[model samples]
Target chain A: MEVAYLGPIGSFSYRAVKLAFPDAKLTPVATLVDVIEAYEEGRVDLALVPIENSIEGPVNLTIDQLFHQSSAHVVAEIVLPIVQNLLVVDAKRAPEKIFSHPQALAQTREYLSEHFPQASSVPVASTALAAEIVQQHPTLAYAAVANLDAADFYGLVPLAKGIQDVAQNNTRFWVLGEKQPHIALPSTAQKVTLALTLPENLPGALHKAISTFAWRGIDMTKIESRPLKTVLGQYFFIIDLVSNDNIKYACKEMESLGITVRNLGKYCIYEGEK
Target chain B: MEVAYLGPIGSFSYRAVKLAFPDAKLTPVATLVDVIEAYEEGRVDLALVPIENSIEGPVNLTIDQLFHQSSAHVVAEIVLPIVQNLLVVDAKRAPEKIFSHPQALAQTREYLSEHFPQASSVPVASTALAAEIVQQHPTLAYAAVANLDAADFYGLVPLAKGIQDVAQNNTRFWVLGEKQPHIALPSTAQKVTLALTLPENLPGALHKAISTFAWRGIDMTKIESRPLKTVLGQYFFIIDLVSNDNIKYACKEMESLGITVRNLGKYCIYEGEK
Candidate 1:
């Protein structure tokens, strides 16, 4: 299989792809926007994109692209526990400056504040980009916060491990493409993503929309709302349901009530090794 | 009054402040996080922060900070139409690279793709930072997508004006402080921000929570949901109601039904000159 992910060989997306499909040929891209563009153009068979982190809520561009750009469906999801570490090179003493993506810096805030309060923090595009920069300037007193894979890929030594403030740091990644996943299922598709839009903005519009799931006792794993961009108060809601059967029922109920329902594909999420 | 705004000087927040308070003393800070930190520490009498753009929805850090860190209320708001300009030090040479904040870059995607398809784009912390970099390195073929004030502040010439894809680009800014606004009002506040959390996650919890407002004909101007951070699938709903009387009625109803509701603030939004 051919797969594309956010990488310079050692970002978290690279790790996610590795864990989910160990034998796939990997293509690395620079930006989230590029990933979607590449997938839409059929440059890669599958694109692995980070959807949300437990600490950071949601990755903004990924959400925007899923809403606005993709014709592809989410075939599967991979949940990876994030382990942030402080990696440095040739530093007999503490580094004066540290670099990482904005989300990484935020996740390790408490650790950095306690260990190196005086150090300056710089945000680059990604954790892999930070690791790459630290590699180019080997003589400078600089460090990075990234996954364990990045330290090995960039040839840096770990100064510290598990530096994230909250212990339960995890990210859920999606596999988007034309083909659906053949692995990790319980005979029934375990999850379904639905995008719904209201015909008009009214006081009870949202209440009526989600009640379809509530009335059926379908467990909604996630619900996110974004503005329709037509005017000030209009919005579209993305709902994640636990069962595909529930999705079928809800879509029919919603459409009958004049709400527009767009099914964004249904597949089982990868639940890790047996 | 002394106010803090997101800046390196001459960013959109600066423009928002100038329009809202014609005589207040201004102090520029680097990030949305910094602006709140400065405000909480009592270093500034007021902090002006961007809440949502008509295009970009809500600024994440601003929403997160106002939810987690502040005791301050939103006293007033300012709405400004955004006009992004491509500022270059010298229009004589074709630039090889362009820089701007990620949102600014996203807003001008069509313009960049059409005009400079071959140019590499760099994402900086702010649009002002991008302008500063282009100014300091004049020999490098670089340009920035920033406000008109940034072009004036950095002594750069405009390569283009109002290059945003959408003709109706606008942003809404909040004035956060301890006291209520003595400025524009109808003798009673028109808007009130409410943060509500459910006692537990259920299929229809959100449907029920929102129905309190829906049943009353309360016009919701905005509603944003963020993960509660305590667990996955749990969320806090930030609801912006248009009427103060409606907020009182809804809060009473929600509390009676065993839902938790926290009033963030009640303030009038600045409806510019007649």
Candidate 2:
């Protein structure tokens, strides 16, 4: 089995792919688009990308591509509590520049503002890139807000362990694959993901959109409004809720109510170590 | 009147601020947090920040700052259609670097990838800073993906106008202030935004959350689930829809349903131009 993820070498995404598919051959790609493109083109078996973060709401790029533009199925999900460390060359010296992914920078925002108020921050492609760049330029007093895995991979020492301001900073990664899982999931698996597009621009269309599920006493766990892309103010909703067979019924019911619905996947949420 | 906005100068936020309050004395701030902080601390009369984009779902920084972190009320909203241009030092040569705000960069990802595949894209603080830096570094072939206003302000020439992949890439800006408008708003100013917290972790809490408004035939324009920031999977919902005093009644009903609700604001949507 082959897995492609958004990476340089050792990103949080790399950590996610590793935890989920320990035995699969891993391939690091430049962008999230590249990961999905590779999968769509049949170059990879699965494409894994960050979908949401506890600190940052949702990875719009991944979500937009999945809902508005993709043919691949979100077959599985993995929630990893992001463990970020400050990797630096000179621990004693106050660094002038801090580098990391935007999400990493945001997670450690409070810590950075409080500790290194004067230091300038830069956004890189990934945390792995930050580590790689910081490692390559040893003369500059540059620190990377990245995972310990990245530090270990790049032979860098942790300046500060768990530097993220919020301890509960976790990112949920979605597995996009052409083929569905051959093995049956556990009965305890409950979450079902659906993307619904309205038939017309009716006044109460959105209110009615949720009514189908709500009337059935189904829980609406997460709801996101994304642009239809064709017109401004028009949106398609991406909803995640707990269900088993009721999910299929709800989708059919929504379709019957004149809404175009897509079952992105029916998978269990990751309940692993934090 | 005074207004605080994200700036170095000449960014899209700057454009929105100018469009909304053409005569207001604008005070450019360093960050969205700063703008909100300035407003909360009474340094400025109003704070203007991007709330949503047609391409990108929502401005997480502004939304997060306003909802979970601030006490200031979001009083008004202005929607401006983004007009981005390809700014260049030289039209003949392909630039090696493209600079812009992360939002600007993301919006022009398709155009950049296709036209300047080899040129590395750098994320700056704002579109204004990108234009400023690109202007100062004429020796280095640096181009900026910014608005036409920035190009004119920085004395940079536009390589291509309306270069955004999507033509209707509009952004909605929220006005944060201490006091709500004194005068009575027109009845057509019906969109009301609310932030609601569930009292307990229940199966149908979310379904119940929206039912208060949905059951009453109120149109749900937009519903977004944002992280409560206290817990990982826990969320506080932001709902916007067309309503009058019915929104207040719905809020009361939601409270009756044992949910903690915050009236973020009752403001009219920008309806100037498409």
Which lDDT tens digits does candidate 1 get at residues B1-274?
8999877676888877766766888898755677888999999999989886522223655776787677678878776777898989999978789998766787788898899898888876568888998999899999999988889899999998989876655577888898774543223336888888887834367778788888788876666677666776577878888864766878898898888888878777774322
lDDT of each: 0.76, 0.75
How do the residues B1-274 of candidate 2 rate in per-residue lDDT, one tens digit apiece? 8999877578677777777777888898755677788988888888888786522223766788888679777777777778778898777777899987655776788988888899998865457778888899888899998887788899898887777766765677788886653322222364778888887655567777777776677777788888777875688888887756677788888888889888888776654244
lDDT of 1 at B45: 90
Count: clashes, candidate 1: 0
TM-score of each model, in listed order: 0.88, 0.88
lDDT of 2: 0.75
List per-model TM-scores for chain B. Answer: 0.86, 0.86
Off by over 4 Å in 1: A53-60, A182-189, A201-203, A271-274, B53-58, B79-82, B166-172, B182-189, B201-203, B271-274
Query: Candidate 2 residues A1-274, lDDT tens each?
Result: 8999877667778887777777888999766667888998999898888787522224776888777567788878777777888898777777789988655776788899888899888866457778888899889989998887788898888888888876765578888875554322222355788888887745466666687787777777789888777876688889988765676777787777889988888775664345
Question: What would the per-residue lDDT of candidate 1 be over residues A219-242, giving only the tens digit for each residue?
Answer: 776676776656655677777888
